[model samples]
Target: MKNEEKTKKRKAKRKLSTGLYKLAFFYAVLLLIIGFTLGVVYDSFISKGMEDEINKIIELSTTSEILYASGEEFCTIFPRTMKEIEEQTWKLGVMIDELESKNRIGEDLKLKYFDLQVRDFFLVKKASKECRINPLIIMYFYTNNLVECEECYEQGFELAIARNSLLEKVPIKIYAFEGKTSHSVVNYFKEKYNISSYPSLVFIYLEDGEERWLKEEGLINSNQILEKALTFQNASS
Candidate 1:
């Protein structure tokens, strides 16, 4: 009777051990799945947060206004191809039509005058191998109201005449205040960099996906503009 009781006790103990082992295995698998799921969720959240931050920085920092203005001015001053000239003519026509529709006859005439002046400025049959600087500077001469309209017109004419003599160099982008406005592109750069000048030249260098600004004085001439461009090129290199 004692042997029978011992056998029953042994059987009960073995069943308990087996049950515990099964429970532990199930729990281990569940924990591993839970840990992997949490890890994936955390990683996704972190990646999304980083992308948002990067987008915000781009929105706040990119100087698209300046770039656009510069591009328009470039097209106005020097069109490299026939297509560009046609586009400029179309733009002038549109401006004339708009001004006439507004009953601004004098302004429409001035627009026509300006269109002719721009065409004469850019219609050089022979481009000097030299004077390769970007034509945006001439555009600034026209766009900036700091100078009188007549003065701007004369400057554009003079620039065209001197185009052959000036040394050809790569284009350097400079930002100037358009008017006394709070949210102007110039204001944006000034607020960001504490700039205090009318025609501040901000040199930007992009390295390893980071932008770095170089300290430089304002530009008035083509030479200073070229120097700033070279500085940015060297730093980026």
Candidate 2:
């Protein structure tokens, strides 16, 4: 009777483990499918000339300022791509927050997300340069693990509120990035900026005819954000 009971317990444990693995896998697949579906639907609506705008961005990646000769040129096509960049990056930020909240994100989706973010980061730079505006940049970096970086979502929420408040007064823009992606661009900035911790914010602004940045670790309130943002806002003015 003892030997029979032992065999039954072993089989039961195996079945339970298998069920948990399947549940995790189902969540991963469902998230990816939802992501892909949303991408397809969004592209269909904004399909016209989107490819050309992206190519322009890609060219800017190589030549940087050369492609952006005049504000007029970028002004014409840049609005559409600008809209695309903002939507893509912002939506992914929301998706990341949602995934972390539910604890259901997979490794594959995160890699894809990081790629879009890096690309859109370049687009933001391109837009600022061509538009001849020294926008106050708020770069929020965090990871997928909620347990590791629980404050990340709160940071995002506070920054969103700060942006809403400061947009008219300071020209502030907030962008969220996944800090632990394997993407080379993400890795490069991580090393260059000494980003050793999660829930990091990098504030980039124009000062003394050059670009400068201030890095902060952990969560910060909207009031603090408004303080630093207004400082840059004054400097640029």
Candidate 3:
């Protein structure tokens, strides 16, 4: 019976090993399912928040009459609102980048995002003019490396530094557009401004109560152009 006992013990050990492997596999599958659920939940939460922020901006833009009526009060309210809007816009940009990288964002959504951004720009520009503010617009057109956009980021950075040095008195607005945007706004801007290059930097200033584009001659030396513009503006006013 010793032999029989040895066989029974061996069978029991094999059964225990199989049971342990099954348990480990079950736990592994459970962990994978849990992780996947959490990721979905997190993504949903972020998307909802992003949608809410975008909607608020749209609502604000749509009711621009309220903004126009602010008069002096508009300037008081503008800085804070602009900061919030810019922050949200930056976040939206990050989201767009991520979605685009994954090939998940659709053309419709991309166009809508660009539309909202452009709408905000016009609203801010109009508000600045009504408030008698000299607004500077620096536009960056990046094509996600699909095409060569030489020095776009560099120019944007240099302009940003210049803008920051101005001490926030001037309403300097910076906007970035994916040149490959599946929207008409890109074409509209290009046609209106005679923009031909990918990394083209356009500086817009208010002149004689109308929007005017700064000359190309002024652009080659970026900082000098801005300084001269500032000096001329200061002397003019």
Candidate 1 residue-wise lDDT, 82-168, digit = tens:
233323433443343344334433432433334343333333211111223222222221233444232433433333333333324
Which portions of model 3 miss their true places by more than 4 Å? 1-45, 69-80, 98-108, 153-169, 215-237
Best of the candidates, lDDT: 2
lDDT sort, best first: 2, 3, 1
**Alpha-carbon RMSD, each predicted model:** 24.4, 10.5, 6.3
Please list all clashing residue pairs in model 3, or write none if there are none.
none
* TM-score of predicted structure 3: 0.64
Name the lDDT value of residue 147 in candidate 1: 45
User: In angstroms, how far off is 153's CA in candidate 2?
Assistant: 2.7
Cα TM-score of candidate 1:
0.30
What is the per-residue lDDT of model 3 for residues 1-237, given as tens digits with 9 covering 90 to 100? Answer: 999988887884333578889999999999999998997777667666666777787776665647666554677677667766766776687686666556655565567777888987887787767666565666666665633655555554565566556535554566667766667887788677776666666667766676767433112345764684575356324
Q: How many backbone clashes does candidate 3 have?
A: 0
Q: What is the C-alpha lDDT of each candidate?
A: 0.40, 0.68, 0.65
* Candidate order (TM-score): 3, 2, 1
